[model samples]
Target chain A: MRTAFYISDGTALTSEAFGHAMLSLFPMKFKHRTLPFIDSAEKATRCCQQINAAASEDGEKPLIFHTFVNTEIKHIINQSQGISYDFLDHYVEPMEAELGIKAQPKTNRTHGIHQDYNFRIDAVNYTLDNDDGVSTKEYGQADIILIGASRTGKTPTCLYLALQYGIKAANYPITEDDLDNLQLSYDLKMHRHKLFGLTIDVERLQSIRQERRANSRYASLEQCQLEINQIEHLFRQEAIPFLNSTHASVEELAAKIMDEAKLERHRY
Target chain B: MRTAFYISDGTALTSEAFGHAMLSLFPMKFKHRTLPFIDSAEKATRCCQQINAAASEDGEKPLIFHTFVNTEIKHIINQSQGISYDFLDHYVEPMEAELGIKAQPKTNRTHGIHQDYNFRIDAVNYTLDNDDGVSTKEYGQADIILIGASRTGKTPTCLYLALQYGIKAANYPITEDDLDNLQLSYDLKMHRHKLFGLTIDVERLQSIRQERRANSRYASLEQCQLEINQIEHLFRQEAIPFLNSTHASVEELAAKIMDEAKLERHRY
Candidate 1:
């Protein structure tokens, strides 16, 4: 198999995202074996061993993508008798020339700007009324409120917006209360302009929710449909902009939101 | 004051990280303001308004580092009057090129054979029993295990390793159970060679934990001290390789881990 690895000496999600993106851009001639992490000599040995075994069995070598960071493992693998792989660092050097301008710094006015933005996103995640004595202000302070039913990729999307962009993105479940009321929270109403809605295909939502709380009322497709319809109606009535979260990756959706909202700019 | 907006029409943290990295590389030469998460036309207007108001007060011009993905926002910003800004898309060209090479598909298997040797390093922040959920029977599966206490910079380190290199990294936290037992899980013990520990300054750990847990028992300095001591002792007893997860940023840590671990080389 033409295996491709998206390995890392650390977390591989981002790399995987990039890798997937790259793969999507290109013709898939190879069987991709994207590994997100390879952290030790032993692990390297095991990978080597597996490759060797695979080679012996198939009477041909399988293509491996070595996305890892440990040098010792590199050395062993480099000196290894067999197996195919590629390292990403060697390929990144050419791109350095594009960053012609040097990065600049922050001043007094920029003091703890990160802290402020982070707090804003956290503020939005907190449920004020029913919070378990934690903090409510953090959730309320969110610059953007994401409303959706459960398993609509709301948390991940909000987190992506918050962690990657440093935007204060808060998400609240369009709970039964909100649905029954046929309206959003008073707090949300006050910040209606900052509200964005995410809707997904019923099947996709059900599958995602299944991974978490399974066969529950919350994960039910019918409930999802009802809530989605109610939420969509509410969004229409309130004139809040919304998107079909289905088929849209977090990156695409975040880009769409930012483009549409023109959220305030900050000196990152 | 010269105000600059780091408008992220996308996720802001990545922009912020890039911004911080850039700022560190090149210190600020002008009065600057960093406004993050400007995701819409109106928000952009509001940001401009704020900047304009500030500029009127200081009689200075503004510079903006707009990190965006929405072509529409770019169009609007391009149309806006008298805003000085640098678009990140113009800068990321080189980085993208390098990523392309690393991610390119290989047609030749002879050379690609030994390329899967690179190992990944994971910087675990909490007490995880195993490296993700990947089983040990899959010995060839893990790249590395980063065992450490909270706020040990595990997440960023892992991310850096993966982003900078193509390594598959999995992290597991060394929880109280692991520490008290003075042993890792049966699965990990079997794959001990893949285990790497990340330690940080107790004070630093306390500070990081404080941000997440607040004034809880876990965030206490004394608790931190005791847990660190226990974990360290356990590491020593097990003869596990380890790193101090303090002072160094993500880039530095990943580089060091790669060098130390001798991660395998990818032939391709």
Candidate 2:
């Protein structure tokens, strides 16, 4: 059994995300350890020792995935016996050459909270307050209004967009009544330019609803099918771009919506 | 004016996050462009041309921040006139030398959604269902229960932890009755081990509350101060680990809670 380490100068999310993605491609049985906020040289030395110890015990060099901007700390970890894949060192030089500019390397900056932190916080607040069509008081302030049948991955996607990109996203649930009427709500029509729709596979929708209310009409496959069909039809008729959320994760959904809507992420 | 580009073989979040962080440190005006999912040699060639054109127009080399796993793509982009900072080329060789293994170069693996995507979605569902002490049906299933006064950043943090880390977090608001009585709810007491408290500065809390209901008794500064004091006292008496969310962003708050509680993020 081999060991894999994800180390970073900040929250280590990038390293962990990259490592998991890469490991998924290879048929390897490995134990993974994540070490974040290794911002100092001393911490880097200790990390190297840990990696070396793991390598010795396993009798196989461990794979280390790292994203560190600090050169001194990266150098110290490079001396470790484990095979390291440093994210910054590998791509910075070529990018510098391509751009005709020197790269600026800094530790713990990638995930640090900057001046726009408040903007992200406000976005989160706006998302929560406007969730599930709870209150339309803030609709005028929303950057995007997500409309979907209940449990089509609207709330999670809205929160993800808000938290990650500081995008003011508000989600409105498309109820059975609205689907029967086959019309967009007056409020949605007014803000139609900001409206994005989400739909899901019938089976997935039924299963998701089943988890909330089992063996009921709401959770029945037939009901899910009817709702999905109407919602897709409404989307096509209204010319509002919609995505099938059954196969897409929230991140993919958010990215797709942002790209399609030409919505700029308010990150600083 | 200068052009700054974030280029990547995958989602480009790492390159964008790093570039933004580094640029924040320097007082320079730059127009930023992010190009994600540039996974092929053809895409790389097009990106280089865009960078070159921008450089020629601006009469200054544009800054390119890139994370590419493909060596050929990286080499092609490096030949461009713009200043290129390639994340992979600088560190992969040293790491390979140290670990005696060749780096597996692949694109778009870092942020790929896999089987764990369902787990994250389930977590988000759980969090939203249990938010703001609305339902105790899933309190028994919560990995962590965040308790705080209103407008103290409980809901957003719970959502962030769930969406970003796949942690099933639930939040319960400390209402006026609970504060006046200075006691935990029976449900919260039953699962005190999972209870985590959040407190904010009195003034901040007042302002946040004022935004929701301006000039009301509930939104008064005195009410916020009284509630905070009571909550802090209750936390100390009950030996509940709590953090001050007044100055911390949701990301920082989530990380601190996960670390303090030793809760493993269930992300795949």
Candidate lDDT values, in order:
0.54, 0.81
How big is the positional error of residue A233 in model 2, measured in Å on the Cα after superposition? 2.1
Give the number of the best model, judged by DockQ.
Answer: 2
lDDT of 1 by residue, B1-268 (tens): 3454455543343333333333333444445444544667787777667666766765754444454455566666555433533423332344235234333322211111122322211111111113333344553555666667755656545543443354555666667776777777887787788777788889888887898799999999999998899888878988988888665444445556765676642212
Candidate 2 structure quality by residue, lDDT tens digits, B1-268: 7898988766677677556655644545687877776768998899989889998899988888776667788888888877776544455456456545666765566566776788888899889889889998788889999998888889889998998888999999998888778999788999999999999999989988898899999999888888899999999999999999887767778877877788886775
Q: Give the lDDT of residue B35 in candidate 1.
A: 51
Native contacts kept (model 1)? 0.10
lDDT of 2: 0.81
TM-score of each: 0.53, 0.86
Badly placed stretches (over 4 Å) of model 2 are A17-27, A38-53, A66-85, A89-107, B8-10, B21-29, B37-53, B68-81, B91-107
For model 1, what is the error of residue B99's alpha carbon versus the real structure, in angstroms, after optimal superposition? 16
Which tens-of-lDDT digit does each residue in A1-268 have in candidate 2? Answer: 7789988866676677556655654544678877776878898999999899998999988888986667788799889998877544445455455545676655566566777787888998889889999887778999999998999999989998899889999999999878768999888999999999999999999998999899999999999998889999999999999999887778778877876788887775
Compared with the true structure, what per-residue lDDT tens digits does model 1 show for residues A1-268? 3344444444333334333333432343444443334567887777677656655655555444343445687676555434433323432332233334433322212222343443432432332222221223555566677777765656545544553455667676777877887977776777777788888888877776775678988788887788788888988998989988776545456656765677653334
Q: Using lDDT as the measure, which candidate wins? A: 2
